[model samples]
Target chain A: MTTTIPATTTAAAVPVGAGLSMFDPVFIGIDEFGQPVYLDVVYHNLLAAGEPGGGKSGLVNNICGHGVLCDNTRLVLFDAKLVELGPWRDLADAFVGPDIDYGIDTLRRLLVVATNRYTWLLANRRRKLGPDDGMTVILTVIDELAMYSTVLGSKAQQEEFSTLLRGLVSLGRACGMPVVAATQRPSWDIIPASLRDLFGYRAAFRCTSLNSSNIILGQGWAEQGYTASDIAPTNQGAAYLLAEGGMPRRIKAAYLTDTDIYNIADYAAWTRTPTRTTGLPDMGLAA
Target chain B: MSKSSPRRRFGGKSTGTVTVIEARVHRSSARNAKVAFVLTAIIVGGLAAVVATSYLHPIVALLLGGLIGVTTGAFVWLLVRVWPVIRLLWWWSTEILLAVVLLTGWVQLANHTSTLVTLVVVAVLVGVPAGIPKLRRLVIAWSWCLIVRHRLRVCFAQFIIASQSGSLPLILWATPTPVGERVWVYLRPGLSAKDLEGRLDKIAVTCHASTVLIERASEGNAAYVRFDIKRREVLNARVNSPLVDVIDPSAPASASPLTVPTALDLPDVEVPTVTLPTQAKPAGKKSAPTTTANGSKPAASSADADDDVSDWI
Candidate 1:
């Protein structure tokens, strides 16, 4: 579907509006056979795990880029590194950076929003949120998930963060609040099977070993010859994507440079300003 | 199940009873065998006596029973023999139904109109499919589906290890895909999707496609597999995100504290070059320069390093 840009009502104002919907399929990258791949993030949670500098961050950024452009969408970003998801922080509803307390607070608020949405859904006799529901899609993207779950917090606080994040991941999907998390450490301590299984879509970037790849995709995937370990070190964005298909598929994630990220973030901020006019139709002459 | 004789039973001897007439004719094993021996015998024996009882004369009844039994055996054998052909017709029922409709439509038109109109209708039928790309693609794809079945059978005969009885995997229905084709296969004993995985490259070559992917079709059954033959590579090239286009050309981006990069990259900075230990210097050749990875000044690739003129510090 085409993104509708609302026209500027005043002569002094530049045309600024975002009408992209999150319910639409978000294009991620291309599969091995050149088929463009998309994610239905509204209904699915995505887990991206790989070795350091393996481009899992690139996949996370692509989702953030899309979320910022969508009109009826709210971004909740958690970047312990800050740089990976830093560009779109200005546009985010809540930006959590190296702060466990803030991250936990944001997640709790998200869970509350998710609960209210479910109540509304039940009252409307609907199973899940729809594009027509006019609800904002609160997309929470966490770069370096291990930081919140392992680093920067005490044991109790870390566990709390994990628990709150899990609750949001579980109840948020059907209520227009989906989570996209990425981590370099594909370990049980960082991401247990209980939490990993909650994500319907898993992208395994270049891993150091078969076991690491298995943790990201599943058991037996490496043995079946669909392993991220086989990806070369030089191939930055290469990954094995698992979606609705029972088996994982080889893919290369789309990339955006820092310049591109900043460019998008700036535009999104301007469009999302409280004073930005909306509900106006374009009446200019045909281009 | 098979071509076994009941006379050679669990311990030999039929036990000499009218239980011979009670031997079941295996209707379920029609596809498993070319002939149903016990079934034919049961039909011959059971129906003959029933037909003979209608006659009153003793000698005449005996002759009638012999004739009826022979007739029953012949009919049963004929059905058992032609079972394979019947299965083929059933498999192509869609095409057969289409042909029937077209033929019926032509006849009705001929009854109502002249010969010229019928010829024009036929011409329209031929032209319409040729004119529409979707229809032509569908017809071609379905045609390939038929071709792929034979190709896959040939591949199995050449490479796929058969069961102890020399039975090959049963090739099932195939459908068309955008990149290539997807075919389903039911493997016999001693065959699994794992056995086919290693031989995918060879299968792709045999199918005249670029590549092939084999996956388990059913979770409960390991023998049922699906082959996805790919004729193109979609991810060979790098994909640039659409966010790049969102930038306004006339207006510059306003960066806040969070909008700035972690490490500010100074654009247009000349990269610092260093002398490497592994530099190969010829007697009269110039030395090449090695550069650190700068913001946009990309680190020279290995080949670029080899070709550049180096400056010894």
Candidate 2:
């Protein structure tokens, strides 16, 4: 039987308020009622997981497009699957993909930025990063995270990646650098428990199985009627989002076609300004 | 032996080892004498001043001299004993001054604005953004950081007092982590992380946190105690485990695999034939023959015959 859940206001229906800063509520997607569902990513990193063809990329694109459009936000794209993110190459502050070693290097570079930002924040005695701060908000997008992890040839390389990503995940929020990673598989083998636990905001589209759905969300979530497994294959962009302290809300991500992506990329590229990049010399190898 | 004896005889001069020792002793005695002389001179000078001031009463002069001498001596001893502590306090004077100024300002502001207005202002400032969960967490985390920065020493003092440990734990620093805030505290001599763990709940309660975790600090006699300032519910939500089984049995089973039976059983009984209805044909149309030229009833009822037969056929 199809479970009947109480309908929620969707993202599109929610009236956009005046004087809302970029650091304020971030628009995620539309809820069941077609009202816009806005979430604050200021202090919470996001994780999006779903089966292949389940609109994970669409949801990520929606969020990333919003982020890129924000005045003081910068995008870092790590596209392990090269096809999905190739169109937005010009928009991103740093784009890494198509090669495992290059992806690792990009991550290392971002790690350095995270560390430096942390030190700067600590020195300035500021906890939250806002438009008031001279630096821009950094939003790192890692597409096909499972593939990225798998490409790490050695255990040590994986561990290093995990540690750096952990630092960014754990401490990046305070520095205004939040990571939003999408994965086809939400298994512990793909996304380690340590890294998985750091994601405070989780969204799951149509998952392959109940196990995958639960892994993306949390234990007893499926039981609580927040089952992503029940999402029909035809409803590709539909997902269940669990904010930091909020209940699961079923929302349908606004679909962005190839043309829409090109437009966003064009806009972002036109408006983009060069920001400071980490000057640390490359580590030469994946290790 | 004979050569050594001859050399000894030739060298009439003494070794002078005893004279050198005597000279060292004399030098030490002279230094002591100089210190004693300086002390005596100061005392004599003070006494002389007292005597000069108390020309009218001899008894009063003696009493004043004794009191002054004792007071001076005690003051010097105390200063020598706690010079390091005094230096540290002096170095921290700016922080203390800032704290006092802030407290004074707050008190004045509270008096002027009244409690209600102050609360309203604070609520508007902190509570508005706190409506967002992430912002709420950020605020809580930042407040924790403030606590660690300013009031951690006071909290540690209270913990020490409550524990009746008779000594203070040397606090290095308290830093906020992803899970919670980590406090580096040097356990006093003869203490361990276990000792702190025993009183951690009390500390956590005082700090308005859910719990405390004590681990050995990376380097030194310090222990890292993480104060989980976030509500227990929030922490649980952040790091929850995945559901193992489906809760709603009546819900649609989308995750179930599609299955197909490999074999089927058929009955042995023969069936009776039914008459087919004839359709109207146009005057000029002719009907096609159903039987094949070489067929023995077209191998009727065979699996291949059924495969070839369409609904139209």
Best by DockQ: 1
Segments in model 1 whose C-alpha atoms lie over 4 Å from true places? A1-12, A32-34, A112-133, A230-236, A245-247, A275-287, B1-38, B41-165, B173-181, B188-213, B216-224, B229-234, B242-251, B257-313
**Alpha carbon deviation, residue A36, candidate 2 (Å):** 0.8
Interface RMSD of 1: 17.9
* Candidate 2 ranges with C-alpha deviation above 4 Å: A1-22, A273-287, B1-313
lDDT of prediction 1 = 0.73
TM (B chain), model 2: 0.35
What does candidate 1 score on TM? 0.61
Question: A1-287 in candidate 2: lDDT tens per residue?
Answer: 12332322212222111223448676655664446677777668889999888888877776676675566677778775555875665556677654455656777777788889878877988766666886877888888887556543334555566677887888788787889899887677887888998999999988877778899898866654467886778777778899843667667766677656655544444434243232222212111
Docking class of 2: incorrect
Q: Please report, as a residue range, the 10-residue window in candidate 1 chain B with the lowest summed lDDT.
A: B18-27
